[model samples]
Target: MTAKIIDKHCAQDGDLRPQHLPQNSKTRQLNLFEKALVPQNGLFIFSAILLVVYAIAPAAVYLIAPVGESFLLLSLITICAVTSMLLGSQISLFDSRFKPSAPRLAIDRRVFIAVTWLIFIAFVLITFSTAPSIPIWTALRGGATSNELSQERGEFLKGREGAGIALLYISTFLVNTIVPYSIVLLYRVKSSLRHWAAAVFFLFCISFMQKALFLNLILPLLVFLAITRKLSTKIFLPVIFGTVGLLLLTTALSLAGEGGDTSNTRSSDYLTALYAPSNPIDYFIWRAAAVPIFTATDTLVVHSEQFGSRPLMGATSTLISSILGIERINLERFVFEHQFGGWNDTANSNAVFCIDAYVNFGWPGVVIFGLIIGLTFRWFKISTDIGFQSLWLIFAFVLFSAPLIGMLLSNGFAYMLLHGLYIRVDRHGT
Candidate 1:
């Protein structure tokens, strides 16, 4: 009965086989593709819970830091947990031939590891060759007046135009992006890692100075790969527990910081800005559940203190200034200034697009945006023939790098749209 129920839940949604999956035992594994075909009630409830939690947490967090942040943390945990289980099962199922073997080799697969490694090396070289130089004057400008400028200087102390710097950034981006993607392709194509040295050499060349990018994306992939290398199950268990502990601790710390200033006066100031509700429950009721229902109600119409137009204008104006041969232009600064009045608020936490998308179009827009993102993931899975061997590392690379790069560039909407569009469907597809 339990098995039947599980099957029903798995069958409730779209294609269950996500391209990036981890290897495991067959009898115990939950193959998302095959399981997706079976009917199951559990998966349906699970997905619903995840989608609901994800959709509701942000609005709730806006009202009370501890309460809302806690919920958000839980939601994030749930997503990762369910995704890992489902993906791992599917990968294990597909690699049934190697289920009993400690170390499996794919002799029949067409996507040889050597070819993928070579392609990745070529990509690293291309990235280095095409990278544009950062302006020296931009680093030096406004250093005396603003402390922010001093930190920016520290970030660019290495100087941007050097061949060494270029090689570093190129190699880092390639390792984080191309190498992992190639690993997925190689796995799906069932290839051997005979050219691992060549691949690593190219990665070393490309990753010289781009330390931040490497940390956020490439490191995660390496960590995942190391954990599951068929060496020791004991080590893998500790690593998993450690990772979860770290995530929870980080999330708790983040919430604690947000809760530091819980003054009523400050709350009042936030309330004034809201033009909506004061409490968490009321805020959700007002914004999500009520506003749409009472579209004709005049009191429900909230006027934002700041408008989105100014940032749009500022971004464009800065770009125009650069084109007109201006001495030093920082488009990000201009955009932030116009959009947020240079405030140190959460509004500045991520790209303006994350907030602006809603400010412009509201909840419907948010849901549509999420659905589009989900579809993009589906497409990425379909187009790529990513194999089970090293798929986890690849997924880690994609998941971490896409968001990190997106956040850094402050291209929230663009981040969602472009990453979704560009992540080729098959992990190893043509």
Candidate 2:
């Protein structure tokens, strides 16, 4: 009976698998051609190839050309990252025994709903308390820019320490991680409340004017749906277009909210500004994707004289600091301090996994980090066999393993490890 429940929940609603077959017989043996056609496999291959062409190739060019030692280092880091992802994907494909299993803990629907409401209410109350005079409607309508919202948020948290600082951390984690996880789980279970909850949470993130927060929530949800086959292959185009449209819309809203010069800008003007030749798509690409890795590499090169190679130190420090509630060494701030002669909080960025690994242990560190990431993805793939429970796994991986800017250093791997323990304890009653 338990197996039947698991199977039923695991089966995609519109899956083409034959309904009359025994559960064991449902595992279809696919030929090479068919295997290649699987959406997941196709996506993996495409990503691997794209990274080589777009990321690695340019870096390679810079290294070979007169771009100097900085470019060479950047290229090496990029190479490490790309190689790790590819290697990880290949490793995952070969490991078949790591399939997903059903959750041991039963999900109480009522408890879920209650917790979600509590979190949402708390989030709303806190947001309002922080920025009491900022009208939600105006924010939603793009009358409030991201800079304005960020400044207000900074003000609210300014000089806050001790319990206040702790509260800020707790609230940030709950809203960003727990709330999104709950929404995805509820939606997977076909809860009617999910739509309303999701809408409210999305708008709330938008009001903050930070794109990463919104993407952090939605990307994982999309990945969950895709892995579960809940998202139809037929609608892939629509999904892509929809996502792009949403990103553009949100960006326009933020731009419009900047006030003064941008407040009265028309929709066309916003679109033009986004796609302008000088600051074309590449501008966003560089700022959002390439610059962080480059900055990390540059920082390492510049500070080569000051700090000797201490590879495992970076990841270890991150893990220990995270556990002890200490601030992880801010590599970005370090880079900015060196480059501009001072650290600016607003100018913060990430040190992608490769740079993080390389800084601590050099080339070997990069390889190790790559293998771990690859194995993690493979683990997520197998976990899909677990039905609804896989939602959390998918959400966690997608949320943390952000492209060009994620790895084990930032508590993502640690969370996965703790979650694994929870699963084991729940299953075996240890």
Q: Pick the candidate with the highest lDDT.
A: 2
For all predictions, the C-alpha RMSD in Å is 14.1, 7.7
- lDDT for each residue of candidate 2 in 1-430, tens digit (9 for 90 to 100): 1112223333222222233333544454544433333334543644454355435754765655544465557566666666676677667443433323434433354565577678668757775675534433445655566556555544443324555554445545555445665665555455667667777777676664454456545554554444444444444446556656666555555445543343454433221222222222333454544444455555665447445545435433645556667557666556657655766664444444566667766787778766766655555444432222333333333322232223332323444433433333111132
Instruction: Give the per-residue lDDT of model 1 (tens digit) for 1-430.
Output: 1112112122221112332233342224433332321222223433454344343443455456533232343344335434543443334222322222323222322344455466656755664455442222332231222223323332342334556455434443444444444443332233344235434543343232222232332332232233222223443345445544444432232222122223344433332222334443344334333322121111112112223222222222323335656443233333334433463321111222222223233444334434433433333333222222122333322332122223223322232233333322332333
Clashes of each: 24, 6
TM-score of each: 0.39, 0.67
Off by over 4 Å in 1: 1-24, 31-57, 61-176, 185-235, 241-356, 359-368, 380-384, 387-430
Model 2 stretches with alpha carbons more than 4 Å out: 1-50, 53-55, 60-66, 81-113, 131-160, 175-177, 228-234, 256-293, 302-312, 315-328, 338-342, 385-413, 420-430
Q: Clashing pairs in model 2?
A: 100-382, 100-383, 145-257, 310-360, 311-360, 311-361
